[model samples]
Target: METLYQQQARVFKALCDPKRLAILEQLRTGEKCACVLQQPLDLTQSGLSYHMKILCDSGLVESRQEGKWTHYRLSREGREAALDLLRQLTTPDAEAQSSGCACRRGRE
Candidate 1:
């Protein structure tokens, strides 16, 4: 099994690319077919597929097939989880602040 940090890192890695961010923004309005995404993003079929795999694997996006086309959309639960993770990681902990660092104690 992947460690907690490893799992978290996947989401970060998925989001690190400019193309991926753009793709997410495109998805914000609603679902889009893979073909529709290709032109605006200026990606080839393979390029879009590559990024979509990352987004889907990260749980930030979901996909379905309709005839020859693939449709993509933001995963509501996954997006919420990603938001919660961001808030948790960035928010300061009161107890940690009170404890102080060992390096500070050593200086005195």
Candidate 2:
């Protein structure tokens, strides 16, 4: 059986696709209706829905019904987790900079 981390790795793999990454980038600006995603991506409604379903299942995106439209947005926790993972992956060498690190400088 796959460990919890392994399962999460699968979810992250789904996000690794460029199309899914583009979807997340679009959602980052604000909540968007399904139609909006379809338009920019030149994707069929069903295709777009499939991608959205994958994202929702992985807890990376959230959807809310508003009248006839369903608005989708990025989950805050998911976004922060992604950023943290990237930070951990590319952390600067401590010995490289005697004064300080670029990460600290950028944060400040």
Candidate 3:
């Protein structure tokens, strides 16, 4: 089974690319067809497909097919999950997180 950190790492790794992040911003407006995305992104059909596959794999996006075209959108559950992971990273845990550093111990 995958560890929680590993799973979260996948989500971060998927978003490391600028194009992938741009795609997410585009989806925030609403669901969009693959054809509509290509012009603004300056990506070829296959190029967009490559990036979309990574986004979908990370569970940050979803896709549907209609006739010959594909539509894509941000996933609500995915956004929540990513935020929760970020919260965990930022939230304080005194003993559990301490390394006994003088400065860090002073904060507590």
Candidate 4:
């Protein structure tokens, strides 16, 4: 089984791409169709599809088909889960270590 760090890495890795981040910003307003996202974001349908796959797989984006077009939107539950993981990771450090996260240990 994957550890929690590995699980959260997938979502963070998905967000690390510029194209995916752009697509996510658009999604923050409301759900949008592929064609609607393509023009403004300057991404081809295939490109958008690829990013959508990553985002969807990250569990941060959800999709539905409307006729021939695919519409995408942010997944509220997934965002909550990711944020909760981050909170768990951060809160303990702020309490237990008091100095900082482990990586920063002896550096500061």
Candidate 5:
């Protein structure tokens, strides 16, 4: 059984790829049909589907089917988790820096 951190790591790894990150960025605007992503990214249908499957499995993206189309959007939980992970990764380094660190100012 995977721990929560392990699961989250898997999701982060999925996002670590540039193509997958681009897909998430597109989804941030709103939900979109698979074809929308395919066209903008200039990815083959099979390539797009493979990336989508990884995102879906990682729980970073959610999908719904409407008739013949499948739409996808980012999951709020996944977004929050990713943000929290990023914050955690940076906080320690920021803390070690000068007290006037920009990241610290935002936290205050």
Candidate 6:
């Protein structure tokens, strides 16, 4: 099983690549086929597949195989989950806020 940190890292890892970011922008419009994505992104079939795999693994993108081509789209649930994770990680805990820092206690 993936640890919580590992799972969270997947999402960040996926966002780290420029190619993957472009792929995601294309997906935002709606579902797109792998073939349709090739030209705009300047990616060969194999290149597209490489990036798509990362995106899919991150859970930020989902895919469906239709006949020969794979269709890709932004996953609404995944998007929400990613956003929630970001908020949770960035937001300060109420208890921590109240406690302040031990180092600062002597000065105050």
Model 6 spans with C-alpha error above 4 angstroms: 97-108
Query: Any runs in candidate 5 off by more than 4 Å, and if so which?
Result: 3-5, 88-108
**Comparing candidate 3 with candidate 5, which one achieves the higher TM-score?**
3
For model 4, state the Cα shift of residue 12 in Å. Answer: 0.2
Q: Write the per-residue lDDT of candidate 6 for residues 1-108, one digit (tens) a residue.
A: 879999999899999999999999988899999999999988999999999999999899999999999999999888999999999999988876756677888789
- Name the lDDT of candidate 3: 0.88
TM-score of candidate 3 on Cα atoms, chains taken together = 0.81
Give a tens-digit lDDT track for model 2, residues 11-42.
57758778889999999899999999989888
Q: Which candidate leads the pack in TM-score?
A: 1
In model 4, which runs have C-alpha deviations exceeding 4 angstroms? Answer: 1-4, 93-108
Query: Model 2 reaches what TM-score against the true structure?
Result: 0.68
List ranges where model 1 is wrong by over 4 Å.
none
Give residue 37's lDDT in candidate 3 (0 to 100).
Answer: 83
RMSD of each: 1.6, 9.4, 4.0, 4.8, 8.4, 2.2
User: Residue pairs in steric clash, candidate 1?
Assistant: none
lDDT of each residue in 22-52, candidate 4, tens digit only: 9899999999999998998788888888889
Residue 48, candidate 2: Cα error in Å is: 0.5
TM-score of 6: 0.86
Better of 2 and 4 by TM-score: 4
Candidate 3 Cα errors over 4 Å, as ranges:
98-108
Instruction: Assess each prediction's global lDDT (C-alpha) against the native.
Output: 0.93, 0.83, 0.88, 0.87, 0.87, 0.92
